[model samples]
Target chain A: MRLKATNIEHFYGHEKILHGIDLEIEPSKITAIIGESGSGKTTLLAILSSLLKPTNGDVYYDDISENSIKDINAFRRKNIGFVFQFHYLIEYLTLKENIALGAFDEHNINTLMENLGIGHLANRYSNEVSGGERQRAAIARALVNKPSFVFADEPTGNLDTKNAVGVFELFKSFNDTTFVVATHDKKIIDYADVIIEMEDGVVKCISKKRV
Target chain B: MITPLKALRKNWFKTLLIFISMTVSISAIFLISAISSGVVGMYSTMLKTDGDIIVTQKGIADTFFSDINRSLEPKIINLAGVKELNSMIFGASPVDNLPIVAIYGVSANRLDNYKLISGIYPKNDEVLVGEKIYKMLNSPKKIKISKQEFKVSGVFKSKIGFEDGGVVMGLNDASKIFHKNASMMLISLEDIEAKDMVEKINNLSDDIEAKTTDNFIDNYNQFKIIKTSSDIISALAFLMGILGIISMMSMVVNDRKVEFGVMRSVGLSSTAIISRLIAEAIIISLFAYIAAIALSYIVLEVIQNIQKFQGYINGEITPQLAILVFVISIIMAIFGSLLPAIWASRIDPMSLILGGSK
Candidate 1:
């Protein structure tokens, strides 16, 4: 599925967040939005995923604008999955049930966990797992529904270098799902198929991987 | 959801506190109701006179201070609704300085208030004694009160509580000994409209208050004070429960704001989140209900077993009253938690993300 944002402008009480940003998310490819803290990468990612509405302009999923859809929540649930930087898991639920919250079908939780390499930690609560394991669990949740677009904001912000690399490699394996990640991590930026660099709410550069 | 259940389990102490409080409140209500019923039963038996109206000194509020002029007897007997009237000259006297002994003065041949078991009704110098008091007087045929020698005319037995502990004598003789005129008037009405008759009697004289026996407890100053004060205590207990629940739920919602945000981000709508919180509140209330019912039952059993008060009073909860208590408990649970639950639901899903509400 194609996610396109054209001239997306967002403001928080007159404080500009994203300024007239235009971007096309390639189908089934890993797209990374990289910027420093407060540079609007998370804001841009949120706009593309329909989690937040833009103050001006629009976002389209395969050519259907966000405002044009009658049921915005249904659209998001059916096609988009979100992963926050902090893992944001239900603390009382086992990692398995947390992943099942976004499962496309009932039987996909185990497969999703195994695909993310957190199968052994399935029965453990979110509080009982390590930071890296929690991120893997979050990744499993985002893809468990087989959503066309998975929006991840700073997915490895809480993980060590080793765990961060492991999470990216796991994202790389799901080649059929489009991943849109916002991060300031250079190691994560190096592995993306397309990179969007932003500074102070404006797009600084858009680079395509040569390989 | 299991998340809310786990949260309830985690705060078991709160649930127990509420349960104990509810149990105490409900048990008190049950106890008060039982005692009140028992007291009414006793009054019904003692006041079983054919008289429908009791006339007392204005604002005396107690029979001890009731004093009416003996001269009014002829006038009162002529009033409308006056089927037949009897007057009592009653006071407490001590035998050789013993504990208080109750004494009532009655006219000749009016045996409606007593059943003679031994001797006949007393003349001016003799007295009729209750069965229990006769035993206390060592079953003697004679006793002396305030140095006056009186023969025990008969031993009468009545199940009425206070009457069973007292003595009776001739009206003029009692008046002479007690140095009082008439104590009060007991008038039997020919009609059932007791209120209207009482009003007529009260209007005829300004020194007396006339009322039907049905309004006895309501007009009695001590009883009215007790009822009003008990009602206040009960109200306070319920208010404490409501406030306790509101504060506890508010804390819970405030602590879990971020968790609710995460739920919204995943797939839960605002309505779903509100439903979850309501479910949690209900679970807590269910635990409290079971605990309170058990505790209240135990309290009632303890009260009913007191050897002295046994068979005289019973403590229990009727089905309708029990239902009312349960309904109030559930409403307390729901009303206390609703505002907090709504607040939790209105939380912005974005604010629940990383660095949100920081």
Candidate 2:
């Protein structure tokens, strides 16, 4: 479950969004991507999540390059999980159904919800919860599938300082779980086992702590 | 496979819209079919007025206007396939200020051929009138014909359009009012299986034509005009329905652009998204089918009961037609949402995550 993006380059129409970038995400280790607004941090995350394809290079899940993979969707569904800033929960389903969405039969959504402090909200509708609670619920849903890799884009971007710290702590508990978090929050820097900084769509700094 | 029922519950509004459009389109098709069937019903009613073949003057524009030579009966009766032959006269005569009243002169022996709904067949100069014409006159049960003051003898009911507006009396009594040999002949074959009865009768005499009741009406220019017109109208309705589906589906797909994008980012393939949308569309169309059938049945029933149209105006709704509409709506919905779903799936996930479209 190691994710490697090799010399990745991407553009939107004529303007380049992500320039030649290379990075390696360690298996079962928490990695943090930090950058300013237009530094392509989210673009790199999109590539790792297999939601976008880099124009010049390819993503590697362990030894297999994305191009050699016959079914990228099946790969993503079985191994990758995504947690966006907005917590895109389907409005029509109750919290329990949404959390249980992509999980295998062995996955326990009720246990995940309880661990995330969202057990009582299982029967509630998406709109009935507060923003922080909803974010927690989203995290619970992502983990319920027990994906090998989890991608988080600005997970605490919309939260207050207290809730922001709480969310970062939630990610820290997954130290033995592979997680690539994209954020501009200064408060989450201490929780990272590895920190990668992006500037103008290229990697600027890579700092790691021996695990 | 995602359950369509689940999707419907999640996206109730979109589902309802698809259902409504399908219902309207299906009902339009059914309405058109009912009107066309009404024509056929009227034709069948006309056939029930006689047993097999009807005869008229060869050169006459209409059977009611023909002058068949009464002496021809002997020649026709002795023909190989002939069993029994009877004659009748029909014409449009003025009734006071009323524009025209249809008058029919029949031999007493021929009265038994028709099913009278009410009253008895008129004898001598007395006459029987159609229920429709009789009701239109607002006469109090009894009415006078030709000032001879005959009782309202009988009211006959027939599916044929001709019987809808006419009065019947003895041929001798009618001859006194208007000169006529015989207008038409109602003939039944001695052998019901005779295939060449019409052909044989046609060869028996000049200035005379014989045909089965169904073929005779089908040959009418009036029936042809109506048939052609219904086909054209049905075609137009079908086209409009397709266009309607396309337009509405475009709006629906456009409205759900962000939703589809979200689905794609959640590891759903473009094909999966397309399939889900199509499934939703089909479920919606099914709802509409049920609605349209109910609405159409109520509508046709009201028309039949209120108007009392004797023909097949009260049409039958078949399950095949419902299934046809359901499948057609699904196809139309898939085509409509196809391009939109593809566009949504092709969206760069980075752009969406960056809150660019917001």
DockQ, all candidates in order: 0.37, 0.41
**Which ranges of candidate 1 are over 4 A from the true structure?**
A1-7, A11-14, A50-76, A101-107, A144-146, A172-176, A209-211, B11-231, B294-316
lDDT of 2 by residue, B104-196 (tens): 777778877657888777777567777666666664355555555556778876545446556677887776666777888888787665448
iRMS, all models: 2.0, 2.4
Pick the DockQ winner. 2
Candidate number of the best lDDT:
1
lDDT of 1 by residue, B291-315 (tens): 6667666766775454333223444
Candidate maximizing TM-score: 2
Question: Please, what are the lDDT tens digits per residue for candidate 2 over residues A1-211?
Answer: 7788888999978999888988899888778999999999988998888878788898999868988888776677678888888887777667887766555652488788888888899889889998898889888767776788889999998899888888878887876569999998988888888999999999999999765
- lDDT of predicted model 1: 0.76
Write candidate 1's Cα lDDT for A1-211 as tens digits. Answer: 8888899999988899888998899988889999898899887887888777899998988898889998766677678888888888877779998887645586978877887778999899988989999988888777777888888988998899999999889878888889999998998887899999999999999999998
Q: What's the TM-score, to 2 decimals, of chain B in model 2?
A: 0.74
